[model samples]
Target: MRADIDGLPVRELTGLEYASIVEGVSVDGEQSPIMHACGHDVHISALLGATRLLAEHRERWSGTFLALFQPAEERAGGARKMVDDGLDVRIPAPDVAFSQHVMATPAGNVHACLGPSFSTADSIKVTVFGRGGHGSMPHTTVDPAVLASMIVLRLQTVVSRETRPGEFAVVTVGKMTVGSKVNIISDRAELQLNVRTSTSTPGPAC
Candidate 1:
């Protein structure tokens, strides 16, 4: 069994009855609030409890019970890091494996399904280049901010028009950085995009 133990770099809502009070410095050396918004805390706790129970009743079962506590799952590099760190040689490979995630379901309810239950996700960063110049000189500069905006608008059509009906696909431009000031046009603009597609869906959804 495996459970992710990473927390998201997001601030909790104010005026909540059980908001996180702890503050920590992030990997970038900046102070930020941390919260388990993805329910990885619940996953870790559940895995610990289950491991304890199985340990106390080891006589009832026969086999190795490896409980994997993963990290950096929010960035999606935890599993790969573990493998690179010699996880394969340290632990025995099992015939079967199980992992769980907390979903938006009612309490005391557990869901299980065969085949692919989760969607495939990808993160992409795109940078468009242009010519840096003063905002007053419209003819002298190529504006990458405008190009980035055009790309964002065109990406919306990938899901709405290119994707077939009933197919599950999402294309989101989460972050865009352009010029620093209104009077100046930057030479380059950066875009952070996230794409998600259902595993069961056929063809390229995005």
Candidate 2:
């Protein structure tokens, strides 16, 4: 069994009944509030409970039980990093692996399926260059903010118009960084995009 032990950099809403009161600094040295917005906390708790139960009733199982706790799952490189760091040589490989995720379902219900349940994800960073100048001199500068905005608007068509009906795909421009001040245009803009598709095969839209 495996559990991803990472939290997203999201701030909890005020007056939330179960909101985490703890706050921590990120790797970028920005002090902010952090919470398990993806419910990895539940995953950790569930895996811990299962590990204890399986250990207490070891005679019921015939094979080795490994509880893998992975970090940096939100960044989408935790498993790869573990494998690169000699995870295969460090531990015994299993015949099969099992993992679970918390979904927005009923509290006491469990859902299982045979086929793929999650989509393959990809993160892309795109930078667009421009000439920086004062905001008042619009003609003197090539505004990358406008260019980035156009790209963001056009990327929506990738999922809506370009993708065929019934195909599961998502294109999200999660973050866009442009200028630092209101009166000056920046030299460049960066866009962080997240793409998700059900199949691993390359498609025309995704």
Candidate 3:
């Protein structure tokens, strides 16, 4: 199963405000501009506070609240998968859902989307298979290592050559695995990629 919350740092409780007081530790860390830093802790704190308020003021609203702490945004499609896995059936699906991300937008201000909320994403893997052989042999077998390397470079052109400029898309080859030994060429090579888009456009989804 996909993780509940995606893109969030591992320290889940770090986002809570009273966590520091309860745990008797400091929440703030050294500041860095281009780093994994933000006011997410405070925002998460406010969310918790809101939940507390709702629980306390149970009669204030006559509806049930499903406060979801989701995961796997960095991997993409987790939200949709959650919905598919009876998230709506087990809990309650709303006409619309909302989410907020820190560090994507500027500070000192809150951002919201109206129509098209955010980009969609898909993950894919490409495997190239060939015959393995000793390093000293040249024509004895097909070298998938070479072919996979070539495919890796060729994939780069997919975004540049195949995809037009400003098409709001990305194709990234994140992993490549070939042979295990130095003297023997591998029989197969694999490539893992994550693609992103700002619309319903679909590529090869893993």
Each prediction's total of clashing residue pairs, residues at least 3 apart in sequence or on different chains, is 0, 0, 8
**Inter-residue clash pairs, candidate 1:** none
Best first by lDDT, ranked: 2, 1, 3
lDDT of each: 0.86, 0.87, 0.66
lDDT of 1 by residue, 1-206 (tens): 88888877788887688777668998758798898767876887899999999999999999778888999986789999999999999998777765566788898998887876778889899999999999999689999999999999999899889788877888999889898998999999999998998844466545
Residue 1 lDDT (model 3): 14
Q: On residues 15-51, what C-alpha lDDT tens digit does candidate 2 reach at each position?
A: 7787777788886687878877678879888899999
- Candidate number with the higher lDDT (1 or 2): 2
**Model 2: colliding residue pairs:** none
Report the C-alpha displacement of residue 17, candidate 2, in angstroms.
7.2
| Residues 57-170 of candidate 3: C-alpha lDDT, one tens digit per residue | 988788777666544445556687778887878875477765554546665787775776556768888899999889999589899989988988887887788765656677
Best lDDT among the predictions, by candidate number:
2
What overall lDDT, based on C-alpha atoms, would model 1 receive against the true structure?
Answer: 0.86
Q: Over all chains combined, what TM-score does candidate 2 have? A: 0.87
